[model samples]
Target chain A: MSFLIGDGMTGGYGSADILHDCTIAVEKGEIAVIVGPNGAGKSTAMKAVFGMLPLRLGHVRLEGEDITALTPQARVAKGMAFVPQTQNVFTSLTVQENLEMGAYLRRDDIRGTMEQVFDLFPILGEKRRQPAGELSGGQRQQVAVGRALMTQPSVLMLDEPTAGVSPIVMDELFDRIIEVARTGIAILMVEQNARQALNIADRGYVLVQGENRYTDTGEALLANPDVRRSFLGG
Target chain B: MVDILNALVLFSNFVLIPGLAYGAQLALGALGVTLIYAVLRFSNFAHGDLMAFGTMATILVTWWFQSMGISFGVLPTALLALPFGIAIAAVMSLFMDRAVYSFYRKKRAAPVTFVIASVGVMFILNGVVRLIIGPDDQRFADGERFIVRARDFEAWSGLSEGLALRSTQAITLVVAILIVIALFWFLNRTRMGKAMRAYSDNEDLALLSGIDPARVVMVTWIIAAALATIAGVLYGLDKSFKPFTYFQLLLPIFAAAIVGGIGNPVGAIAGGFVIAFSEVTVTYAYKRFLGHLLPENLAPDGLVQLLSTDYKFAVSFVILVVVLLFRPTGLFRGKVI
Candidate 1:
């Protein structure tokens, strides 16, 4: 069974439906990547799972518990964290303060979790005292991810974490994400860099028009002629 | 040495001491304005009127306390009656928010709409205070008036100029500092304070992180009410309480809030002193101050005043205009409060 799953999500911003029978899931210790064209509801699917947008037709389950009716804060308490594509970090707060805010719900010790985050992104540790706004795009993304990690969640979701970063930074981020998955956390990520993302993803999902067009192992999706030509731009 | 000492005494009597007390009052008032702006995302035009209402409540309570033979010894009984004033103000503010501001908030109305609504509240509150307290000035301060008398100072220092330190001035300075320090501690060290800051920074993110917006708003109004009451009572103790006077004082209070950076607490305190110094120094007749520094021939006729005391509010106006024209975000550059 999947650790986290959004099975057959069907909803939109208002009256119109943007997603039609969309299903996505990630198992424990696996990295699942969602890749698609712009306006194809990539971020919307992520938002649905995070409880930002309500699903009209389907339920979201975290470890077999239905969380469809839960608020975002309730979801966070149930070991779920989501990092948006933009404005994901608290800009005015220092990197440490941002991390502290991420652990707002935790009543236990967060220092160890913070140390682990620092280990994942050493540059963040170096610039811990600096405001998150002062960091470069790559570093800011690290802070955003680091903040999410402070909650010590079993599942971590990223919406285009490497959207504006350099190619080198993107590779490094994927490597860190893999390391995080190795520690038994489920990762659900939406990426614009589909080819590179598929290189590291345990499972790859190709969403077109807010519906599942392709689903397979990352290596299989990368090797498929149709996916390579149509979706990955040959 | 003697000349310099005389100049120092004259400056302290006219500008330093009074400015310090007035600055404390304005700082507290501006702190309320800044907090409401930070949390509710609007400039609270009704803050000054809230102060008047709160102070009016405290004065009535003090009168009751006085008739009942209760006192704080050398301190004014108003000091002891402060919590009642704060409680009344908090209740009124929350009621106002529910009746007027909450509807617009639910509509996701613009900041300008809130400002207009607060103006409506301001008028209503003004009318209420005037109706209850009457339009005339009322002095409720009852205590040992001075810590050091002017005659005592002259005798002790043997200086040409005398300096008197009023009990109200000492209390104002001390109480303001304590409140500011406590506020800083609350915001920096407490979980709730950090949550409020998070809400101010990004509302959606704050919600995702589990910060309750209602709790933050309630705390903001409570703190603002308490600060406003203390500031108003202190000002009334130093000067006198007149409902219209607080309405007029709003200009300088806003000027201070804007100058220090509207959403920043520390900036509000600094801005308060800036406005106070500007008003006091500009309106003060500095002939005595200049006479101590310059020779008899150099000390020319006429008061060396930049502006008349009657136009003291004008000083704040010009400063506000200049600050807004140049740096609308204020000295601290908050997120457009």
Candidate 2:
């Protein structure tokens, strides 16, 4: 069993099921990337793992404890942080304030964690007083990740964090994710840049229509001829 | 020099002082409206009635205080009674939220649905206030009425025009400044305040960050209730407390909020002053002041008022329309209405 797993998850937003026995798992200090074609239910699978969608059948376990009944907020208290694809940062709030809001549930000191986040993204430290909305797309993404990291979660999940940024910024974000994973936080993210995401991923799950079509080490999935020709655009 | 001095004093007497007081009242009212719009995501049509309800509570308490012979010594008893009014208003507002707004919220209703629901709430609150206070005007203000009497000012300044400063006007300005400072501090410096801002900025992100929606909504209602109560009491003190008059005030208050940028607090204050000054200056008769400024022979003219006092509310309507047409987001770039 992995450290965190959504085993055999099956559900949808409405009556129509978006996932069918989909499974995803990640261990501590490793990067797990979910990548596939458009409408492959990549984001849906991630949403299921985060408890944003109800599961008709299956269970989510964190450290062997069933958390399927918990709300999304409760999962945050259990040290899971999710960064949405859009509207991730509080546009009206300053970057520092955005990070402060992220640590709202914590009763302990979060200044050290905030400082570490600033260290991770130096530009955010410089523009801490600026409103998150005023920052460029890449800088805003950094602020979003920094805000999520303020909670010091054991698992950090990103939903296409690099969606609109330039290629250079995407690489920078990927590097930051790898660094975050190195800090012993399990990194689970959905990525559109499949080849680059797989290059840095320790484990890769290729989802097709809400079900896992291939689950392997990142290198093996990248080397596989079928994955290359069909999904990765050989 | 004497002509200029008299003209200036006349302008100050009729426009500046009254405008400031009225602006303060409208700003406070609009601040409450803007807060609800920002956090709750709806235009609360019941705000005017909420003010009336709070003022009614204050008036009853003031009467009680007078019966008990309790006074604040040169301050209106309403000031002392204000906290009770605020508490009542807060309770009422919370009850309304739970009983009415929360259901629509749970249903994921559209903004228009929330607005129509608010209109229903408005009618109910309006009837409740009229029933308790009656349709007649109520005078609860009891204090030293004038801070600067016109006769004393004329004698002191040795000018033809006399300037009078009412105690209520001074009180309104002082109270308004203090409240604004405290509000800004709360919004910027406090943990829960920032959480509220975060929630207003992005509801999903705030929830994912573990900020409770119920707690935020509760706090917003409390603060808004306090603001509405204070604004109502102050306005009643400045003029008179008539339930109908308070209901009529909704137009100007909404104008202020929309002109300032619907969900922006700073914009509310700016919008308030803009509307108040426009209404005051446009309706003011400039005949005497112009006579002082011009030569004696050239003073043969009618009352030079641009608009009648009956058309005062129309000024707000015009400004609201112009703002909506040119910059729907408001002067400070607030959320588009």
Candidate 3:
């Protein structure tokens, strides 16, 4: 069974549906990437899965349990975490404090979890005491991901993780994501840099105007001439 | 030399000592205001009256304690009754949140609307407190009068100037410090305190991390109630309790809140001192202090006071205006919303 699934989801901010009949699924320990043209509801789909938006039709499930009516807090307790594209980190809080906040629900000691996140992003550990706002774009993204990792979520969702960073930094972020996937955590991320995203993705989803345009293994979508011309910049 | 000593005494009595006490009060009150702004995402205009309500509760309980012959020696009976006052205030705050504030929060009301609603709550609460306590000055501080008498100071130092420290004033200062220390410790060290900060920083994010908003709100109110009760009881003991005086107290408390960066605790404390000093010093007649420093001709005409005692609140208002104009976020750059 998939770790996370959004089945025939349709919803938006209000009456208008930004995600129309969108279906995406991520199995445990796999990296699923969603990429498309602007306004394709990439972020909206992620929001729907996380219960941030109203679902007019369809439902979301985690570990085969329906969560369509669950509040955001309920979703967190179910081992789900989401990191937005911008303002993702609490800038005022130190890096360590930010991570502690991610593990807010846990009654157990999170020192091991903190160590795991620090191991993934050594730069974060090096600057643990620094305010997140002071970090470089790449380091800030690391802090964002590290914060989500603190929850030890069953599935980690990120919207546009490398939206604004240098090419080298973006590559490094993707590598860290892969490293996170190796630890048996399912990852669902939306990416603006479509080609690179699909290249590293185990599975790729192409969305257009809130509808799924194509769903295939990352290699198949990369080789498809139609996808290359329309999404991947021919 | 004698004149300098006299001036120092004048400054200490009117500004330093009183400012410290008044600042402590404002600091506690503003901290609650800041917390509500941070966690509830609204400016609680009702905070001042809430403080009054807490103090009113304290007065009643203190009166009861006194009648029952319960005393804290020279510390005043109000000190013993404080916990009961705090409990009542906490219940009131939670009820206010559940009945009024939470509906607005659920509706995602505009922040301005929330501010207005708080004003409405303020008036309603003001009426309720008055109905229960009556709009009369109540002095439940039954104790010995002076910790240090003005005559004693004069005799001990052989200085013409004197520093009179009332038993209540001394108690107020000591209690206020203890409360401040306790509050800071809670905010920094406790789990609930951290959760409150998390919700304040970002509500959506907080929810995503499984931090319950309702629990945070409850905790915020509890701390706010404790602070308000302590501040109210102390202020009442120091001077006297008049429901009208609390409404008047709002001006300075808000001025202090605005001055310290609205969401910053340390800023609130600092702002309280700033407002207190300005209020006491601006309205203070500095003629005696300046007369010693200046030539006889320079000390002529009026009391050399920039403002009158009746206009003490004006001092705080002016400072607030100035701070808002130059730094709208506050002196400490609180949440810029």
TM-score of each: 0.96, 0.99, 0.96
lDDT of 3 by residue, B61-143 (tens): 88788778788886677888889999999999989888888998889988999999999989988999989989998877777
Fnat for the candidates in order: 0.46, 1.00, 0.59
Q: Which stretches of candidate 2 lie over 4 Å from their true place?
A: none
Question: Comparing chain B with the reference, what is the TM-score for each candidate?
Answer: 0.98, 0.99, 0.96
Candidate 1, B39-97: lDDT as tens digits: 89999999999999999999999999999999999889999999999999999998998
Colliding pairs, model 3: none
Q: Best TM-score goes to which candidate?
A: 2
Candidate 2 residue lDDT tens string, B47-113:
9999999999999999999999999899889999999999999999999999999999999898889
Ten consecutive residues with minimal summed lDDT in candidate 1 chain B? B328-337
Locate the minimum summed-lDDT window of 10 residues in model 3 chain A: A86-95
- Can you write out model 3's per-residue Cα lDDT over A88-107, one digit (the tens) per residue? 88777788878988899888
Fill in the DockQ of model 2: 0.97
What TM-score applies to chain A of candidate 1? Answer: 0.98
Worst 10 residues of 2 chain B by lDDT: B328-337
CA lDDT scores, all candidates in order: 0.92, 0.95, 0.86
In model 3, the runs with Cα more than 4 Å from the true position are B295-301
DockQ, computed on Cα atoms, for candidate 3: 0.68
